[model samples]
Target: MKKIFLLAALIGFSPIFSQERDQIRERDEISPDNSWLKVGITGGVPVGDANNASSFALGADIRGQYLFNPNIAIGIASGYTNYFGKDGFDDFGVIPAAGFFRYYFTPSGLFLGTDIGYGFVTNVENNDGGLYVNPQIGYHNRDWNIYAYYQNTFLETDMDIQNVGVGVTYNIRFN
Candidate 1:
């Protein structure tokens, strides 16, 4: 019985120690890379007055970026968020185009990011367009990302609307 157990352990250990270093490196090179485009779909709950007037918010976004040494990225972003109506007010929606920026902790998956730009609020009454900004914190990997953020619409001389929510992003890489 002792001999059989020793033989089994040696068989398992041998395969690991016997692997060529070059073969491991070659296998790593064959694996898919994380670069290029990231597309995201998000849902948010309205906060403050925005929530009283609307039920929730939903949006979609796209970004193109270059990884500058694996810790930072910058790109452009645009999306539409629909704020559903509740009882008193009508549905509100905005189309925002912005510049995207992100910084990740080196060798870790945590990140902080932001988007800022002009947003046109087309479906609301008695107000013009506004400035759009989103600040977010998230965990990300090569396959997927998850984040929580505050999205704000600041209409000049008028009320500011806030949407707070979480979102998921899918990553697509190109070689």
Candidate 2:
């Protein structure tokens, strides 16, 4: 009797399980024309004259890109980067607004990219924004990106801020 009951239960649930599997298979199909947003965190140590004032750096950013094909893309990115102060210095930050370009070595993994724009200084007075450039290399897949970048900001005050950093982003797709 117990063996017969077990058999009956399996039969009852088999159709439900198969239906779920079919739904998953349908959802797994991805289209090439989709755009994606990458949301992530970034951190770095100050280089050049920036080291004299900042001990380290940390920030977050969001980037949206439209794929022209499997390998090339263009996008815009914006984020905040904070430079922690050294002794007797106050912490400073920059809100960076940039346009970026990327080339993927493969359809979904490994790429090169760069951002060019302006960094608006924050938490300081009597200052204008600066030129911002970041060149990066990374591994990208359907869901994540891991990268290393060099960031530079050329200030009008005759100072240059530089950083060598690593960042990670999670990709969210839209049709």
RMSD of each: 12.9, 13.0
The TM-scores, one per candidate, come to 0.75, 0.79
Q: Which one wins on lDDT?
A: 2
Clashing pairs in 1: none
Show model 2 residue runs off by greater than 4 Å: 1-33
- lDDT tens digits, residue span 1-175, model 2: 9999999999999999999999776644444344888899999999998899998999898998887667888889999999999988899888889999999999777899999999888876676679999999999888889999999888878787788899999988876
Error of 2 at 119 (Å): 0.8
Model 2 weakest lDDT span, ten residues long: 25-34
